[model samples]
Target: MTKTARQLQEEGLLYDVFEQELTDIKDRTYGLVSELSRASYFDTEYVMSLVRKIVAKIGQDSYIVPPFRCDYGDHVFIGNNTYINYNCCFLDSAKVTIGDYVYMGPNCNIFTPCHPIHHELRKEKVTEYALPVTVGSHSWIGGDVVITPGVTIGENCVIGAGSVVTKDIPDNSIAVGNPCKVIRQVNDKDREYINSLILDDETKNSKYKQEHGYVYSAKDEAIFNIVKDTVHYVEILNKLSNSEIQRRRDFLRTFVAKLDEGAMINSPFYMEFANHLEMGVNSFINYDCIMLNNAMVKLGDNVLVGPKVSFYTAMHPIDAKQREQWLVYAKPITVEDNVWIGGSATILGGVTIGKNAIVGAGAVVTKDVEPNTIVVGNPARVLRKITAEDSKKYQEELAKQKDINKSEFDKMMAGQWYNAMDYSMLKLRQENNKKTEAYSRITINTLSYKDRMAKAIVKEFGENANIIPPFTCDYGCNVKVGNNTVINHSGVFLDTNEINIGKHALIGPKSGLYGAIHPFDVEARNEGIEKAKTINIGDGAWLGGKVTVVPGVSIGKHSVIGAGSVVTKDIPDDVVAVGNPCRVIRKITEDDKINPIRKK
Candidate 1:
């Protein structure tokens, strides 16, 4: 008896994706998904009913946010108390099993189909395979994560944000990055951390001490009740449509201590103490902002707080014993008038930003920022003082930039389609090739000469950074390697555009980073139209032998890409990812630490 396409797929054999049976199932699933998407998010009972009709099994208290997509609804199984956030996609060609008490953040994707590598075979609708994906009980998957086919995430695991999970993750692990690896185990420290947030009665009385730079407990009954109420209020505010502006304002006025006239905060804002937050007139707080305002957090007039900015006024004791005792403290955070806090910046407790200050993206502010200055990087060092000349320079540049036509090179640099075979581009590539070829010709034994030639080949070559003599790149000038980075033998960096490698990186032998991307359309390809995207390898990343990173992919800090992996997307920091089409297996953890080997 011959097996059907569905049967073949389930049996881990190659099958056609466009089989009549699969297409019919998918069409049904799409109808249900469309219905689910159209339904109101507030209609909980109706939403759950639709979800039940869609999935194979939905345990008690399981909820899926609207706008969810999946190939076959019957192949998806979700356990009890599982809360899946918005815009999640599950390509359940095979079984997709999600365990109980699992929390999946927004925009998570799970793929169960593997298409043929050969484009001709794929075009012919042959050699597609499906595999199961399972998430164990009590696991948390962060936003924008992708879990590939045949992957099993063990119980009590924490998969961090923006991870591409391609392999099995072990139980009780905390993993993060592109190809996620275990960074640590879920242990007593985690439990203690949670416990330390809960305060006893005696510690609660020390609230006055918090204002005076002394330790206090925030777990007071009144505070807990306030936080709970705030959570409920925020949830409602977040759910409300943008059209209900007046209603949102009214709710905010009632919930927050002082929300001045003309001040606005975008939806999806989170706060522990809403009553402790004060916004001045005309101040604007962007989306996904978080304020743990145990103490007062005040933003002055005309302040611009970017998206994902966090103002933290809480602190725990440094000593483990003291921390375990639940001793915590709070200090006020103040943003003066005309301050601009960039996206993803964290403002720590007891910090003040002087007027007209600018905090750069991803900066960690620990101390006060000086007035009229631009601060950037970790620990928020002052990049430069704001000068009158700066305004003039930018204004003049803006005037000159208006309605200007960009060249092919400029378009290419901006990640737009361009003529790749232009004369200037060809000349640049030819010159780069000469330098690379010259560097390759030098012997490894001639250390000084080789090092000098290596520097001549690339732009911005950092101190102690080394690329073996046999390494190659299309445009050496587009490559910028940081201090202490090493590119092993036979490495290929097709740096059509910028390829920035962070410090302490290890690019294994035969590894390739391809920045160039040709158009998918045959006509565009024939016309020599192409574009290039930047590839970034973050600090301390290790790519094993024969790993291939495609255009626009960023391997995050301290990440490990396994051998023979092909990275197609961004990998977050601190993970171990492996497989063909690399995915995070687990995260790098403290347990992975080993003592330095001694000489025999």
Candidate 2:
């Protein structure tokens, strides 16, 4: 007969089991914590009440951000004025004691349970044991840091970003890196240096430099000049009139640190500092991509980046107050040769995407991706290695495209589509759409408000460029509709990836332009992951009512899509495409343009 949980705990046994029959207290408590994790980040009192119910003891004035979790909260203890950041997880299978004035950064994990290594020992009626984890008072744990079981972090410690602590740490030390080690002790000399850096400001009674220790005077000549030049480039692209391809390319190349021969960046790209941004030969950067390069970001030769992809090298303090003070740091990001990053993928700081790796769309990559591997979903996991089967399809479909190399990672980079539904992505879209939905409710009849709404998407609305109200998008900032473009009412333009509409383009009412899509597999779809591709509608293009254009599609210059057509494939220039899976019906001729006639 199986022993009761209390009896098993008294004997020190395993508990992270899936099929085990937990008691009502455990069931309800775990369920309650799940609900609390889904609660609003702003609901401090409510979440704190729930936190108190779960933890063994929590001290006064200690605040934990919502969406925190533990296996058994009853084994956890927290001290006074301790603050935990977003999405922190603790496995309180054994005791977890966090002392006073502690700071925990976002995405930090403190696990106290170890699984059995022996296969036979994991069978029914198996025994288990867990080690405890402790963090002494007045310490700071950086983002993405992980502390393993049986680790006791000392008081007044500073654990650096991405550090993994597997052993005990002494007090008043700075610990960092995988298998963390102390670098130095905090001393008064550090305080003296910090005091000297502080700037004085006038107040009624006294002068003070800052509200937090993290704040410092941020000044960089390179970054300052880069920002100004980049802004000017964006303005030029938004109002670009002449279609001199070479001139356009030349203008765009000046925005980045390096743009090799045959490299192409679809217009309306965004970056914090262009000086640190470098692109190798024949690399393809699709529309509406955002690169926050506080540190160097380099993409190797033949790299293909899909739409709305983002690389962030900037990060802030774990302490909320410190973040408010705008104290920040950054790490560089590098993409090796022949890599392809799908649309809507977000690569985090200090991550190096290996050569020929394919990062699936909508993946929130927090770690380095291995070379020649395909990774998908939140905290992206490797799906499989690039095989011959994948390469065969690549040769068949996009053979005509230049720089379509068969390097290990680039073959069919966009072929594998998986579903990844993330909480953070969902939350962001929800917040963004809320604002767009409000704009949708505004009176479409008014020209001024309509113009104001159009400004949300287009930087410079050209001669008669306008959008009828009832518009919806993930973010308006990525889109730039060109001159004489008329987007009809109730248009759902999913601008998660950049949507570029050229001059004289006519979009019928209720047409949906989707730049990103989720995995089709039921399980993957449930994961809320996505793959994005840019949708480009060239000049003189026309779309009928209720047309839907899927991701990574391009409607060629002066092409026409019939009513209610679903465009899954790219249509060539000056063609008439129509159908559920829209196909070309006929080519546009001079006879068809001046006067209407049936092609016989």
Candidate 3:
């Protein structure tokens, strides 16, 4: 008999299934990569082994392979022979699963999990959450792509590179752009033609059939069954009764405990902290990198992060209208595999950069970026298409530079380097000092009432979590949040009645989440006689900096709210919403296509 939830909880065995799968994937990927590099050409067994590892990593099998770069020995899973080409990333925070025969090009990333949005809490040392990523079978991920947390990529699709996938991708057809979209269908002829290229010979055809468990000529249910039984990780819940604050604290502590082991960073520059780095095989993080990485950050294989790159998955809010409010928010940033991020770039809050996409220099990306395209400028726009020419030229340039600059680079890196664990120890000491300093209970008067409110606000946040001030609300009882969610210092969350927020939702600095509002009528507004309802912020929703979510609004599951926008209405599930009054600018694309719409 299957184990009960109670039994699983008692043993802490709920995540055990995922842990085993992850281990298997790590072993397989390590073995396969070692073998394939030695083969004269594409070794079918080696490739199959790699594919099996990805499948096992994700808890599912039967994935298709795109013509792509396959590397690493970590938690990675791909469905049966999914077509993946040069430059793809599966930076498995927890685990990454891809469905059958998915197609992809250069510079693609699947980034899962991020950090909190408050520097104070980060500096104090706290644990954050990680969300899983899934790509369905037969999906085509284009070049220059990025896939963010808890995102689902659907089947039989085409995604242009240089597009950022921030939410779930649906099945079928073609999608492209900074935010990928389904533009057309992948008709029967297209499939046939593509298959013909692989199935030209009987020997190759037989191998494909045996490995995939079916002939290519017809779709088979047995193959589908094997594909369906993949593993997945679900967040387990403890039944103990406790205040919201205590629960948050416990969760953070537990999550941190799991991450304490395994120092995962390697760099060629001045390292502030090295112990917190989590990297995949064939992944290279360049010089002059600074990360508080206190809240979990991740990277995938073949990922090229440029010099002087600042990854701040932490922030704080401070303002009178919104101080120490609890509404379940945190901003985490993710960069997918095979992605090329330019020098001096800042990727902010719960942003997911798709695979094979190029982020231009000095760009301040305040929102999610798409795959397979070139993005430049402030707030980053899709500037041009990334073709084969671009890929070849860049590779040649990289190789030539590696040859010319290797010895000098090695000599430079030989001194004063740091690892990922140093950051963890530093954070631990800093937080300990803060606790020692707080023995006398320093109180801020003149804002005495606000202090009480701040206490109530703190009740909704996790320990070592920061709450920005300058906001007011009707009642505090109705607001609640999960662990490790941060509310910036100045942001306002007016919880007049009930407001429920899930774990690891990124809410930016200076943003406002007003849970109660009056009708436009003056008398009703003035009398405080307005009807009140609840606002629900789901798990993993990323609200950008300075964005405002109006009263009675329910931001749906895993949606991305762009920065500086006024959200005047309701937003549905799995989308990237931005602009004034917050229109549904685009449904989160699944195919990871970049530059879908030509700017011209």
Error of 1 at 361 (Å): 8.9
Report the number of clashing residue pairs per model.
Answer: 16, 10, 121
TM-score of every model?
0.48, 0.43, 0.31
Per-residue lDDT of model 3, residues 71-148, tens digit only: 232446655545554324454545677765555543355655343322222222222334577877656564335676
| Candidate 1 C-alpha lDDT tens digits along 196-276 | 544554543554555555666555566566766876677667666433456777778998989888677765466767878
Clashes of 1: 16
lDDT of each: 0.70, 0.63, 0.45
Please provide, for model 2 over 1-600, each residue's C-alpha lDDT reduced to its tens digit, 9 standing for 90 to 100.
977665545334654233354444555565666667555544568888888988888899888875576666888899988888655667666789999888786546776654332222322322335678899887888655668767899887888754557689999888865446788887766555544544454331111121122233233343445555665565455334222345756877767789888676654355656677788977777544666566778998877776546676765443334433434556689899877776546687789999778886545577999887888654578988876666565445444545634331122234333222234444545455555555554531333466766675444566667676556676675577887677755476666566888887777654668676543222232233345577899887777554667788999987877654557789989888765457798887665532111111
In model 2, where do residues sit more than 4 Å from their true spots? 1-3, 14-23, 125-127, 203-600
Candidate 1: 10-residue stretch with minimal lDDT: 591-600
Model 1, position 581, has a per-residue lDDT of 49
Cα RMSDs, all models: 17.8, 21.5, 22.9
Worst 10-residue lDDT window for candidate 2 reads 204-213
The most accurate candidate by lDDT is: 1
Task: Pick the winner on lDDT between candidates 1 and 2.
Answer: 1
The TM-score, computed over Cα atoms with residue i paired to residue i, of candidate 1 is 0.48
RMSD (CA, angstroms), candidate 3: 22.9
